[model samples]
Target chain A: MAHSSETLNPFENLRLELRRGCLVLAVLAELRSEQYGYTLRKALAEHGMAIDEGTLYPLLRRLENQGLLVSEWREEDKRNKRFYRLSPDGKLILKQLLAEWQSMNASLNGIF
Target chain B: MELLDRYLQAVKFWLPKAQKQDIIAELSEDICSQIEEKETELGRKLNEAEVEAILKQLGRPLLVANRYLPQQYLIGPVLFPIYRFVLKIVGLCYLVPWVLVWIGLMTFGLSDRAQHPSGSLIGALASLWGPLWLAAFFAFGVVTIVFAILERSQAKSRFLEDWDPRKLPPVRDPNQISRASSIFELAANTVFCMWWVGIRSPIIVLGQSAARITLAPAWRYFFWGFLFLAFANIATSGVNLLRPHWTRARASVRLVTDVIGVALFCWLCKAGILVEISIPTVAPAKTLEIANAINLWMSRSFPIVFIVGVVIAALDVHRIVRVKTADTRPLRGVAAAGGLPQQ
Candidate 1:
């Protein structure tokens, strides 16, 4: 029997909630190295964290808006692509966030 | 390439006007790259179906566009808890009570006409569902409108931020004030008060007979007192429903009402001949005999009723003192920390 797309799974809902913040963090960290939307998604997927272009593109725009990332249009391989990379503000935020994440991870590990 | 262009256009249609061209350009580039990657994997160019599959994987155009749009909620998550809390209170205080009263009045009316066979209770309930549902929907609409207004004005954040945990209500004791039981008691007391005040004669006719036994002059003599007592009981229950905390003022009010009730019953007992049985077909002797039996039973029962009221009054007095003392120093700390204090 085919399951309806709208049929709810609590686990999936929870996974979405858990992923929401983690996705932001991952995007911020990955933008430290310059990449366009497609290449960034491929890079994340290669490292076992696949992000959809829809999510990645919006996130990049949002981060750029927040001054956490910068973007520019450049011709690459005869096709125009919008490239995104971490801004100075983004680099500072990333350092603080990594420390916070490390502390949280260490505390979690101790508890486990 | 044409399929990808159409897909990007669909997404662009939903994007914000300022960012339309920029978003579409980026999306078009990404799709072209994905198609290139797919062709490399398959060792051939793709068909329309393959491109459509990629678009499907990207998700619905509106949903994909929503990620780029600013997050919007009619009632934002921050205020949702308060909205839910208010809705719950409305349900418990308003909707639940409304539903209970509907069912209760139906049952009360049926009980009076027990001699006649009414249709199934389920059928009666089914018939009542339409009006009940309409009322519920109206309540939901009002709540939604109120929350939507709050959201629009951005007043929800102010409400959340300004809230003080110190002013939170104390935990209610299950024994002292059961909301369901209080509501039921309030309903019964309301019905009784209405019967006493509104009706000329409060009597249930026995069997299918036209004859009825009505309350005697004694009831008339203490009619105002009976009403005052009943109303006081109703009022006390109401205040408790609105504010369930057990405090000195509340306890004092209940104690005074209960004492008046006891006194009223005592007066009725002393002023014998409470209910006069009226049966035109019956003999004078039989009528006197029935009336005497009823009067005697009522007079005998009044003291017991008085005693029960006294016990309740005593309990109320005890509660009042305890709560009053708790309001003072040392234990005042407890009150500060969400203890049962006067509203």
Candidate 2:
């Protein structure tokens, strides 16, 4: 299937929000192993979902504020990097959100 | 150093004063770390161009900083519901009259004209143009008065539904008004002088014909009175801005300005300055051509000027309310907690 840029236009903004929504789950799921900002962005992109630094940076801060994620700054190679990991609270929330997503998808598909 | 400086400038534009320095420091550290990672991945030193490109791609610094700030609404958090309500009611009032006028005009041709006897049934139905116009004028007057009263009462109440006063800047010392009043006086004088030209033009042109009982010189006085009132307002606003303590006096000045503006405008029509232009051309017809022309001009211009003045006054009131509310919020919050200490 050939996908054109025009076809992608309507989805562009929606895609960003949907990706942000899923990033909560993705970050929690990924940070089961610790990762820094650039590494996480690259990892997500490699999995066919590209996230910008602008979006990733704020989401990380907000998740940390909500106590669903924890971060620590470490000096490596003479550069300080903040590494984020999934808190126990983040893991629980991610699991619940995933379950909710699946149920909603099932119900919507059934109705359609 | 250059890259760090650019990043700091971006953050400074968005963040508040207290948090800006700390946020900049953290952002710089994060960017440096990202650059190192990028350099390692590419197996080369990242050039200035590449680093700048990455930062630019990060989007505006304000956009990034705004994510941390709470959401803002047009009417602000406190007045949002009330604002929506007032907007809906005002919208309905305007829409109903407008729709009725449109329907009446449109159906006039379809209806019987001989029975109506005014060429159009709508004109006959709306024969009492006097009462309809008066009702409209009264409605506008009541709305303006209500808005002004509500604005002041909201400031005084310091209710939870009202805006947070803390967010507004502190009122400057009242001394600022004395210095500012001179400028306002100049502006008011200029406007008045222009209007005086408009007023005196017909008298100069029409001479004795302009002085007839129907040609009221009293109409010209309203314009003069408006100019004087505008000058008084300039003085009061200047004094209020400069001295900071003359709240009541400043408000009264504003109220007087509004009243004079409305009165001068209405009387200008009633006195027939608007009719002056058409009277010379249409006098042979002598069939109310002058009055019709005057009505046409007023209907076209009055609503526009009235709306513009109301909007400007509303904005001024909003600014004043914001300032006053900010000053009294903490006290009100404390008072609310203490269970009604004072009137």
Candidate 3:
């Protein structure tokens, strides 16, 4: 079976490189309210950014590791689930990133 | 459910040791939610095949596990361009010279060791290939290891930051002649011209033997012509040392001199018995035999010399084209720096 990162076509590889940065902003934006792994994937997919289960789990771990996100295991529906939310640092960084994104988008529109 | 248990176990086996139980617990929760969602739609629990399909969608156990760990490679993208440059440096500066020396040894040195059968030169060359490839492989391995360590350490950025563009060597021009080489050629040609002028009899005594070798009377036709070509060569070399560039005038002079030199070689080549033994009075046949043997070596060497002269003349023709192109090329830096008068 092909692995998650294996043999993406040329267009797919480029699309992935373009999407990698946006996914971080998207995750931080959605984690404003607390959500667990499955629900977060469902929410992102509902909002037109379907992430792979493999890709989402590790990205959450990395963000938590970097102090941009915080996670805690809590009991729900008789089984334990890891819940995640953006940290205060994440909120500050996200605001800066959104401003940067808007300025860049306006510059690109001017060029176009 | 059993298949799901086995799938989670496979993934857990490859996860980082400290985080295995925690990651597996979260992954198990996600998979359970997925299966529960599917069962609600189907109005029953998922079969074994359905469980396998869901696990396949998550991806390979190792790949899913690997994403949580830090990225690893022998050389990462940042240092890869420099890695390629180092490899080319190894090829040009290291491997090429070693291969050339091996070729030189086979041609000049080892040929002497191989007794006179020219075919043995090829055999001697074949024997060295194994060792040459082994040395190249060893060099490649060492460069890769050094680059790998640099990629992983903090020193990569420091090495890049410390580089000075000003210290790079100046760009080389192909048409420019080396002053040192021109000087050496001029000196050697001057000595040759002097030796040619001092020889009155044109006689070559073979050591203390009475078997003296004398130039045939036919050589008298080419002596003055040969001396004139030598003087012309010396003049060209002298001019090159001062200017150090392949100007059209210098190339023309060298071409004309080479044409005349080649004419002399072709003219002398026709003078069939160019050398003869002056004293073989006792046996006329033996005298002819010894002279034939000496002339045989001469016959083999002159064609190689003739071909080399032709090739040099061809190169001078190319140099003339280069000189014309160099004339047309704009002096950009000189113009920008206000070194040239305003147009």
Candidate 4:
């Protein structure tokens, strides 16, 4: 017998929910260093947090729309590219998020 | 490359009109970058099959575009439960009653209605169908629209959050009757009592007797008995409202009252000539015949009241037995435990 793609695991659903919030935090942290869409994706993949392009692009646009990030279309490597970087608000938000994350991590470590 | 362009075009078609071009262009540039990296790895240009693999990994065009749109619903999640509740009430109060009455008329009223040209069973059912369907549709549509508007209005308001859990109704035991149903019964009994008192004289007067009928003189005697039963029902409803639970004593009272009611209605059924229609203008024989016809109608209806009363009385008996069994079971458990050694 073989497992098929249609087979669902409850653990996978829960893990996806856990990862969703982390992905937003990871994207904001990465945008501290300016990068184009492809390089940012490659960089995140290198760090072992692999987000698909569909989710990544929509999330980028959403974050930019919320004024946490800014983007510009410019010539890079002789091709038109949209570069993204953190805004002033993005830095402040990132600091708050990281503090919350660290406090939760410490508390979880203590409990475990 | 052509296949890639077509995929991007398909994705763009689903994207918002304002950002479609910009999104597609950015997506195209990213795909081209990935293809170039892959080619560099392979040490050669990639074929169509290789490109298609990359596209499949990226995701289907519709799914990718859908992610860009915010979630949408006719009635949003916040208002959905309330909307469902309102529909259920409509079903219970309006639709269920309508269906029951339709069934009753089909079962009983068909022969009486057959004198009319359009009163065949199928025709009567079809006539009911049109109104029932239209009424249900309109009821649902109106409720949906109201909730959709409410959803929009409450989206930014604290209407949901402002509610306190303490203000919510307390949980009740399954054995206990709901206060709402008890209140409804109380109101209904009160109405019946009032109608029983006032309807007699008006019915005898020909100014507005629809059936031109009169209750038999025996009903004048039967009235006090029926009114006693009505008061008993009202008293039980009040008891439930105050106590909000059933006990053996309460169940016994209900059982006794229902048995008395069944007896009273049975006495009324045996009472002579329950309905009369006297028309002085008509011939005396015709008047008696008219009176007999109404009497026949009343007699036909008597068995229904008897059956309903008997069912009510039987249910009360069942309830009383149940309460007794329930009362004894816990005590029996306690006694058994007392006999055992302490742990």
Candidate 5:
């Protein structure tokens, strides 16, 4: 069991790298509908794409920094919450990326 | 609410000053929502243990805060390998030598302390270690600062990209110059230079009170030459240790030193053993005959020594030019595994 765990480590690391690219795509795709951090995390988790709060928050900020997403703070449930949504640029990129993702998926399917 | 506030405060302490309030507010709202969701599921307000579990799940305050911070590196990934390389060289050149010097000082002190039982070995070690550690830290700081500047400027990555794979050192062969052998040569040469420098007279004592042969003044004249040869060997070895791939460079350096060594031997041969022997008044004539015979032997052996020196130098030159060319014949796929023997 310990040996299997040890061997799993490298695969786990590579899996994280694989998930990293997918996470950005998922976040961008979800934010097209506009949602706050907690709701966005919940929405993604419901769809079997669970992301940690730590990873989700930082990635949101980074995407915003890159001008692919825009964010605003507004009062919701008697408390101020920061809401994020895809920008015009992000929507354009999402379209292109989705196409790329589909093509890659198709190619992978053929191989498998 | 109180538990949530304390957790937020803990996290805020680690966040950047400019973003502290904004980040804390966002984080507080997220935690409250999570706790509310958990409470709805369990149908009760969370206890202290549940709150603690929630906070642990969020991760350590410092790590959570760090995720929000911009990625920072003193040496970025692009330049990290080179930075590590430079540090290793500095460690080899500075730290190793300093530690060796410290050990030498400690050995000398211990020997002295052997004479006087009251003397403290620990005190001697403490004194040397303090200064050596300070110097090592200073060197480390200087190298880090230099690399940090290079990183900030992004100048080194540009230089690194210009590197050619063809210039990569061939795979090392067992018989070729190695780090251990180079270090050994460097250390031996250093000790020889130190010994030569400290010598008041190069004396050869033959048995007990039989005869004492002191080298002539001509040996004194060649002190600088011998010292230079030793220093050259030391330097060549040092370079080889850092950049073992530069086989041609190592060969050239060895060739120059070998020529100098051969020249020094030729000078010694011309100077005729450079010695004066003194014998006791008892059996003075016989002792003088013995001394004359010894001198005659030295004169006869000089040519053989000179021939050997020439042969060694010639061999180094052949290895550098001919063997290197022969080995490089296959080119691309097959890199030469061996190099000239660096002795």
Candidate 6:
């Protein structure tokens, strides 16, 4: 079974790689509503895209690093929490990525 | 606290020791804040298990940290400095030897023909040229060494930065092993062996010997050696072209070629066919005797070394072939048992 699956594994891996860049866009779009890590994960999962906590946390940090997301620490009921929201730059980039995605999808759909 | 501690431990292991504490502090702060926000949303106190579960779902800490780390280049950052340093060192090493050899040769040339006035004068002038050439040669060596060192250092640094030690690919793939081409390997090894036999052995040995004997045309041997090396490189390129997927076979063939090359070099050293000037002085004779002893040791020991290298290479090739064969076995078995044609 594993032997037969090898043929398609590379193709599947490539498809995953193609989707990796879009992950940043997806995170930013979700964060526009002001959410924490677990909520974001749950939101993505609800949309049929389950992201591992391992993948999400670091991605959030990276987006924060790139100045696409703004984060703040808030304390409620004696518990400290960090909340993230989309930055102006993030919103602008999300718009661009969405337009690009739509155009590419249309072009690919036409060919297929 | 337990969830945060686990994440910190993972971060410390992944980051360099110098930066570990700082990174861990930052990560812990972020995780703590996130947990607080979640507890507030649920309208209850968070239990340790709930926090641990959330952290577990976050996946591996190293994977998360990698996303935040700065991108590093493979070759560009370090190569330049290392190349410069190596070039400088190589130039110096070559220069000193070249100058001494040139002076010694010129002095010998002049003394040999001292009784012939015009010949002696010509010999003295010619001797100076040898030393000058030696200096030039040393400079060239230094330049090349510096470049090579720089390139090597840069390659090492880039490899360290880009290559995730934890995520190393498998050492061997079955498909690659099975398809290893023996013909291409043999052809490459043959060409490499030919160059070692025909070009390098003769020039280095004959050139040194001829120089010692005050031969006027000995310098040509060095040129010949260079030409031969170039030809060998061209032959290697041709082999690469012919066997585009010969990487699997390369290690085995190279091992065999190295063994043959070392053997031939030892033989040439023993035969004295390459030596030019033989002086029967006690001290020089003792030096020659020492050289002979070393050569003898190499000649005797090399066969074992060569065999070992060849054996290892063969094993690697065999492993690859076995995997490839095994991969196709089930299909073949099914086809045979079912009386269906194999695809």
TM-score of each: 0.56, 0.42, 0.63, 0.69, 0.62, 0.39
Query: Tens-digit lDDT track for model 5 on B180-276?
Result: 8888998999899888877646676667877677777777657778888888888888887886644666777888889888878767765765455
Each candidate's DockQ: 0.69, 0.28, 0.74, 0.73, 0.71, 0.21
Higher lDDT: candidate 2 or 6?
Answer: 2
For candidate 1, what is the lDDT? 0.77
Top-TM-score candidate index:
4
Q: Which stretches of candidate 1 lie over 4 Å from their true place?
A: A1-25, A103-112, B88-134, B153-157, B177-343
Worst 10 residues of 3 chain B by lDDT: B110-119
Q: What RMSD, rounded to one decimal, does every model reach?
A: 12.2, 21.6, 7.9, 7.8, 12.5, 18.1
lDDT of 4 by residue, B235-314 (tens): 99999998877788889998998788888766765564435565656666787787677656654556455656755887
Q: Which residue pairs in candidate 4 have backbone atoms (N, alpha carbon, C) closer than 3 angstroms, thus clashing?
A: none
Given candidate 5, what's the lDDT at residue B321? Answer: 78
* Cα shift from native, residue B169, model 6 (Å): 34
Interface RMSD of 6: 4.2
TM-score of chain B of each: 0.50, 0.35, 0.51, 0.59, 0.50, 0.26
Docking category of candidate 3: medium
RMSD of 5: 12.5
Winner on lDDT between 1 and 3 is 3
In model 2, what is the error at residue B216, expressed in angstroms? 19
Off by over 4 Å in 4: A1-8, B38-53, B111-133, B164-244, B248-275, B279-343
Q: In angstroms, how far off is A71's CA in candidate 2?
A: 1.9
Native contacts, share recovered per candidate: 1.00, 0.47, 0.89, 0.79, 0.79, 0.32
Candidate 6, residues A70-98: lDDT per residue as tens digits? 98767644645568899999899889989
Least accurate 10 contiguous residues by lDDT in model 2 chain B: B104-113
Off by over 4 Å in 3: A1-14, B1-15, B47-49, B92-129, B149-157, B177-343
lDDT per residue, candidate 6, B1-343, as tens digits? Answer: 7666766787678776665764565456546656777888998878988888767765577766665566643334456456556566655555544444444334443333464445664556565666576667667666656556655775656554576677986444233323235455445656665665554333333443432332224334443544444455455445655543335345445444444544444344334342333444435666567656655554444434444444455665674465446546675454456544322
